[model samples]
Target: FLFSLQRKSIVAVSFIAAFLCLIIVRLTNEVTFPLILNCFGQTSVKWIPFSNGQRQPLRAHYGYINVKTQEPLQLDCDLCAIVSNSGQMAGQKVGAEIDKSSCIWRMNNAPTKGYEEDVGKRTTVRVVSHTSVPLLLKNPEYFFKETNTTVYVIWGPFRNMRKDGNGIVYNMLKKTVDSYPAAKIYVTTEKRMSYCDAVFKKETGKDR
Candidate 1:
């Protein structure tokens, strides 16, 4: 009789434990889903045990956000977000940034902190077949040619703290050498700031 009673106790305890687990998971789901549903593609989260019966929050590392570029198409681009997790998740949204959390919504337009970088290694400039660009931009003497050179460009001030804020500088210059193999290219600043100037001169054949 005692053995049968012990068995029933064990089964009862098991059922209660499972029910408690379900409750915890449900609460976590409500907190993580409705708050982060539209942001990224998240299928599920798996929780694990820690020391002292403590449970760690589920971690979804990748595929959190997709940043859409501006009007003109671009290859080198990013987005930004705000995340907060200090037992203080209320008050205001903007106060909490995304990088702070294990999740991210989009890439930002600022550089990271503490890195030696250059200007030309910052943002990107792409060239395609149908881009409203020009070929030989002749301004009096110099014939600036935009040949079969399509690329992703990044130019930076190199300091993470830009515009008086913290940022980082990462130059993704692989597109140029990889895409335009054997295409002699010069990414020069003297290269007009606006495409309007380049195209106008090309159409008019005018000097500076």
Candidate 2:
């Protein structure tokens, strides 16, 4: 009887040790995975769990917020291709290849209509500066009306992006959305813009 009792105790101890190990591993991943992703310039990770026990990828709260909806932007892409409008891409002819990516990101007011051979035709996200807002508005029919499905993430100082009727750029964007209701426009929050500057400074050791 003593031998049986010893064997039972051993089993219980092993089970307890395994459970503790699992908890440790879970905690480690929750903490370390986000740091790893941040190093790669990803604003958010994909392992966040919901109340229903479902996992969903989430962008940082400081990231883009929808202009019309006033809600956080929720977007996840397995592979993203950032298309740059550089002279080096003149002869690349990689439009088809870039289009294969799950998401394509562009900067400023780069247009891919004529240069579709080098830059992909589809734009998943466009990061525009306040100064470039005029360039985009130059052809609202092309940028806002036609590419209504593309998400626009504008970054600017609080002075230019504020919504209190004093922000010039914000007022322009508000008018754009009013004209084109289908446009998906988001502006980076002040916190997000500052976070971006911090990341840039950390990476380049120079203020942006």
Candidate 3:
């Protein structure tokens, strides 16, 4: 009877070990493989193909020298503060308050040095307009190179956003890239800008 009991216990332990091994193998096949592939997969946006054999130009084609090479911004934060360039923020002594957030956002080449009492010194992101490109380019070394390290998201109309080789702002950015290699800039596509404008118009009854 003692011998039989020992044999039963050994069998149970072996069966349990086999079951755990099977589970680990299944998980690796189903979950781990795909995750590994996704991690190292091609991250660049593919050009759209047309029936007439012409392919839609990518944003990189518009003269964004390092745009394609740039990795997408990944945020994992609990709080974010979007600070716009509105006149109302001029007098507010909320710099200390704004600095508390995990991420701080500002807009359109706004000066933060003198206005540090109102606006915080830490700039996580900057939302720039198409019209502001020329101004930013004029002092790229100060804004983009020397002092600020803010991520810039430039938005504009279809003509300026398009990658059709005639995009004025796109050309400007291309030239800026040649001039300033250290700046981090991302320009929005025409379709995305149009959608945002439509949403803004619907919400405020005014064109963006």
**Best candidate, lDDT:** 2
Instruction: Give per-residue lDDT, candidate 3, residue 119.
Output: 88
Candidates sorted on lDDT, descending: 2, 3, 1
Better of 2 and 3 by lDDT: 2
The C-alpha lDDT values of all candidates are: 0.32, 0.83, 0.70
lDDT tens readout by residue for model 2, 8-83: 9999999999867764554344544454455666645445534436454555454788888887777878899999
Write candidate 3's Cα lDDT for 109-139 as tens digits: 8878888889888888778889988888777
**How many residue pairs clash in all the candidates, one count each?**
26, 0, 0
Q: Which stretches of candidate 3 lie over 4 Å from their true place?
A: 1-71
lDDT of 1 at 63: 18
Q: Which portions of model 1 miss their true places by more than 4 Å? A: 1-7, 10-43, 48-55, 59-109, 114-208
Candidate ordering by TM-score (highest first): 2, 3, 1
Worst 10 residues of 3 by lDDT: 57-66
Q: Tell me the lDDT of model 1 at 39.
A: 41
Candidate 3: C-alpha lDDT:
0.70
